[model samples]
Target chain A: MEKQVAIVGYAQTGYESDVDASREILVLEAAVGALRSAGISREVIDTVVTANNDYMDGRTISNMRLVEPSGAWLKDESKVEMDGAYAVLYAMMRILSGDHDVAMVIGVSQASVFPTYVPGVMTLDPTFDRERGLLNEVSAAALQARAYMDACGVTEEQIAGISVKNLRNAALNPLALRRMPVLTVDDVMSSRMLYSPIRELNAFPPSDGACSVILASSKKAAEITDCPVWIRGVGFSHDSYLTERPLDKLGSLKQAAERAYAAAGISDAKDKIDVAEVHENFAHEELMAYEALGFCGEGKGSALLESGATKINGELPVNPSGGALAANVACAAGLARIAEAALQVRGEAGSHQVKGVKTALAHGQTGLCAQENIVFILGGE
Target chain B: MESDGLQNVDMVRIPAVPVFNWSVGNFMERFFDGLKGGKFMGVKCPDCGRVYLPPRMICERCFAKNDEWVELPPEGTVESFTLAQVKVGEDGELADLEAPVLIGMVKHEGADTCLVARIEGPDPEEASVGMRVTAVLDKSAESILDILSHYVPR
Candidate 1:
């Protein structure tokens, strides 16, 4: 028999730049918010999972920073340096294994403290790539964007459509960092181009923020909230270590999506998935994800954007909560995706709410959208 | 009792230090040189028309062995980037760097890979995608660390 996992509580700090709080203070704020939201005390949490990178924090063993603030001083704590959703998935497995009943997963990134270019600098392989002075994630995405436009015949106008829609949705989200006046297709086209086919408006701004979620077993979930979102399925995959894969294909994400659909008993994703929260730090990536996640037929992702099928009022609304494209906090991105999806399922997504969001999908990508992909399926109970 | 004054002491001392010799190795050595020279470099897998930046010894996709070096153009655009206000050293010391330093990935021209580097221009707030920029190579040194230069938009 499979074990059941549910999201009992969740909390997040509004995405922003230059948070006045210290790292410990940030952790405490999110942790306390989650506990209060769940109507539970700290002692109820059986295990703790944290997501952060030592390199990002400029410290070795960065998990030590969470000891006091996260309240994991003497409990079972595990640090996942990868994506936060991956950490949440691990927490689910731990509960499924009967090792624990309640778990708290926290993800934070105080990037505002570092020099702006540090991440791009650190992303280099440090051996071969750093020497060649390679560009970071942005550049990698730009290459993919160019290749995608060439392969799909996508126009700059179509790419901007995604930005316009996301930004419009962001206007409704108080936590969104990039809410702007009504933007036009021309505005996106006219925006400063960071790479060919990618404009400044097409990417998410670097925001420093933190998010935390509380997971509980079925029984505990019943006691916690009236609207507990069930984790029907979870899947994660990693592609080839290098960025040399077919640009049009997201092999890892596809495989992970398939596994997640299978686990959730989903036969047809496009028809069943009502809402989707995808991690698209770059604009074109949103289109690529449409193909990779089986939301549309391969090579027809441009059509999905063209038809406005992914808009807030479209057949399948994507990123209704402004998404990573509006407010991107690196380590917290994946968890934010999951948290947003959970909010939709719980009917708690204010202002940016999508209608009839019964079953939602949350997807995350790491390492140039080529490796380290995760997919989670959440449903209203 | 007087003879007991001739007592002795036995002691042993051991000294150990954390090995901190972190080298960028040979493959990285060549790549960094290319950066300092204002050029981007990649290793091509002759078997499959794939080029890897921060050249890899082995191809990730085809598992093909890479032995040839290829130079890439320095011109590219920003893909995605984050500005960091904090700077951290290897020893976990936070450096008082400037408030916001632009760091992002630059897709090199005619290459399939993107390289991460520092963004240096007249105005960081003006940094955006599709803004034409060239890699300012460091001419003073020839190591991975030496590839330090800012991106100036054309």
Candidate 2:
């Protein structure tokens, strides 16, 4: 919101259940791909920001292996142990500080290397919650889902419908992992249930992925590309522990969105934004996000989905790149959302591209049941 | 980069299990002391009157030091629950449990917060929200595990 920063280029890998390449190579590919796409050499990059979780990576000082591949070897660099969207926010801030002209943000995760939900459980209060040994990410999500469905009168059928829509859209996304063009609500409902309301298909598939985006000051952006997606506004917020807050509400997302909207000078989000890329770890989360982002009234998310308004060709298409339900690689997920939105703004999102996307909103989240939320508003000049 | 199966394969199994000694400070020490006496204790915020099932050092809402400790009633109502198909071990890996378990969030009587624990006394599928439940604690216990196994429908 200070000095202007714009996303000049972005790239991401084809998300798979398991990538054959080493993480360093995967990171190098993404970092190099972005530089090539921007038609700029790494010499111009004044800083590099890497996004990853050390706990998830199973090591301390985790980015040491990735630093060189990320093109951060001799440059001013930092890391954010959160979703990639937050990493982009950090890069934008660095550019805005006038200390850096161009900053490349790279984020990655390999969910297959470990039981994906274990690290999530470790995030709970180790003194009691971990000692109790009953809750994990899936179980916590079940609690949130049940509370939300009970409050809103949402049904399992409606939750499955969300998966059907997103997975269906994924068929057109060459980079997504779960591309089921013929996936039906019945198929989704019949999937192995992880915890009651959360079925295997209803949750994000285990994926390995990396994504990169280059953020630069307005002057550097102008030199990099003719079509730069300006970072108009950004916002982020976090809620208290599971027991302290209302389980049915995504209060943090609403708070973050309000801050983002205020900074972007948008009074009516539904009319001003042309497209949106929401990060949903679970199918039910998308419905919750629709309400939290103010796209529809609270407890009316199911109705919003049923109205077919969020479809790829719908009034305000959301997750045209299929979203996390198709392929979620944790830290890489949020950056992928921003990259997909940028592609839409640049008219380069191949098969899933929306028409005339002047403004776009990208969302990212972390913690159990989306305890932390970040929103980014992007615009095309 | 083509692999010739066994010829190119080399493996090292360096499995590790980390152990840490956590300090359960004075606040949690008191709760444990209360648990050893066959009673459940919780912290009450003097300013807001909000009671935490697991005693808190400070009020989460008002940020006031919770100096008052209260005896939590054994009975409570279920707020939400899940029937877990799998369980995780101390090493943070999924362990095979013999049977599926019922977990619930129970808002203890006279407490503003809920406790997450195992549930019993009803079929997991039949464990409905708002069901009345009570803590089943074994008084002759050295650990929290023996102190409270699960909550049963009252």
Which ranges in model 1 have alpha carbons more than 4 Å from their true place? A1-3, B1-154
Best by DockQ: 2
A6-72 per-residue lDDT for model 2 (tens digits) = 9998999889997776678779989999999899988999999999888777778778888889988
Positional deviation of residue B101's Cα in model 1 after best superposition, in angstroms: 20
Cα error, candidate 2, residue B45 (Å): 2.8
Q: What digit string (tens of lDDT, one per residue) describes model 2 on residues B21-115?
A: 77878887888788778778998898999888788888867879998989987899888888777666654555556777888888989988788
- Determine the backbone clash count of candidate 1: 35
TM-score of each: 0.76, 0.95
